[model samples]
Target: MGKRIRVGMADLNICSAPDSIITLGLGSCVGIILYDRVSKKCGMLHAMLPDSTKIRNNGLRAKFVDTGLEDLLAMLEKEGVRRSSLVAKVAGGATMFNFSSSSEISGIGDRNVDAARECLKKYNISIIAEDTGKDYGRTVEFYPETGKFEIRAVGRDVTFI
Candidate 1:
């Protein structure tokens, strides 16, 4: 095992073979992971919201799905990983709460998951595996060398996608 790189909420990072990236406390937030098997290059984004445009003056590129994905892709390209070789693994986006009304704000979790899928599709990247939408927070670890996306939630069995 190589060094484990930690990604904070609304942040992003990348790694290569023998290394891994991780993020914690995903509740109504989504973690989008992009990896290239050929190059063993991987990137993870902890997106807190679905869109950056929804919030004015949001300068954090990794805080939203749209801009976050764009930045991740660009970063991978700079590392010499081709977009065509990229595949994705997604986790988190738990509902986390029970809301009385069907308001837009109540569906942030769903929106975040949808935004990630749509953004990846726009980039022509296929999502190979996922663990999402339960009413629980998750912590994830992605091993670039093995393309293993490990998901862990309290009281649940660890899953590798």
Candidate 2:
């Protein structure tokens, strides 16, 4: 058994072997996990929002989907993980907030999913699996060695994402 590492909100982590990264409390936020099975290298990003365009001076660029995905990919590449061999899995993007307004006014979870998918497409990374879109929170765990990820929704069964 390797050491378990906790990745907090608005955090990004890149690991190479013997380490497992976990993230908890994902509501409208999304968790992106990229892993290279051959090298046992993995990277995880917890994005709070879909875009960073509205946030001008947050300084923490990895807190948004667009920028966070970019940074995660870059870090994986720098760690010697090739883009072609990387497999992506994601979890989160739950509509935790209940708003009676239209989708445009309160679809943060949907927007986050869209942004993550677009970012992955832009990077040419294929998403192997995903567990998203609901009205509950989730906790995700990524095992680099086996390239396995588990998602536990607040009121649902534990599933592999």
Candidate 3:
């Protein structure tokens, strides 16, 4: 197995073959993984918010899906991964609660998932797989060399996409 490169909340990382990317404890956030199979280039983002425009200069540029995807894509391109050859996988958009709140503000997980989808769409990159939206947290592991993404959650079995 290759080394697992851990990505913290609101951060992003890009790596190459023989290495993998991971993000843990995705409760109300989204774990976005982008990979280029031909070049074995990989990028992972742990976005804490849906939009960056609504927030301040919190920290890393990957704090929101909008900016995160934009920056990640740019980094991948610089690493020689063609945009047309890139594919995306996603996880960690869990509700984390069974509350009955109907307000849109209550469903950050769904918003995160939607934001991830919307942002990825801008680059014309297709989302090949996803394991999102549930009342549980998730840990994501992405191996670019094999173009495989693994999602592990408490109790439930690990899922590979």
Candidate 4:
């Protein structure tokens, strides 16, 4: 097994073949993986929110789906990977709390997933696979060598997307 580089909440990282990237405890937050299959270059982000524009104090580029996607793209580009060669995999976005009374605050997970889809569409990057939208939190790992995204959640079988 290669090194598993851990990405914390509201953060991002990159790796190459034989190495993998991971993020943990994703509830409403989302984790995105952008990779070039041929080159085995990969980038991962753990975004805490759907959009940074709505947050006044959003300073972290990796804290929102919109900005996080851009950050990953830029990182990949700097590593000599062509924008056209990138493909995406997304996970997380679980509605972890019951907000029946506060509808406005509910479905943050769904919103995060939607934002990820929209941002990827704008960038012309295809999301090849996803494991999103359930009540449980998740830990995700992306293997650049095989382009496999592994999803682990409590009381559930391991899944690959």
Which candidate tops TM-score? 1
How much is the lDDT of residue 133 in candidate 4?
91
The candidate, 1 or 4, that scores higher on TM-score is 1
Clashing pairs in 1: none
Kindly provide the TM-score of model 2 when superposed on the true structure, using C-alpha atoms: 0.92
Better of 2 and 4 by lDDT: 4
Q: Which stretches of candidate 4 lie over 4 Å from their true place?
A: none
- Stretches of candidate 3 exceeding 4 Å from the true structure: 57-59
Candidate 2: count the clashes. Answer: 0
Q: Rank the candidates by lDDT, best first.
A: 1, 4, 3, 2
Record all residue pairs in model 2 with backbone atoms less than 3 Å apart, i.e. clashing: none
Instruction: Please give, for residues 43-119, the per-residue lDDT of candidate 4 as tens digits.
Output: 99899899899999888889999988888899899999999999999999998888767575677889999999999
lDDT string, candidate 1, 1-161, tens digits: 69999999989999998989999878899999999999899999999999888899799989999999999999999999999999999998888777899787679999999999999999999999988897899999999988999988899899899
In order, the Cα lDDT scores of the candidates are: 0.92, 0.86, 0.87, 0.91
lDDT of 3 by residue, 39-110 (tens): 899899999899989877755688899988989999988888899998899898888777787666559899
Among the numbered candidates, top lDDT falls to 1
Show the lowest summed lDDT stretch of 10 residues, model 4.
98-107
Per-candidate TM-scores read: 0.97, 0.92, 0.94, 0.96
* Residue 73 lDDT, candidate 4, scale 0-100: 92
- Alpha carbon deviation, residue 49, candidate 4 (Å): 1.0
- lDDT, candidate 4, at 153: 93
Q: Provide the global lDDT of candidate 2 against the true structure.
A: 0.86
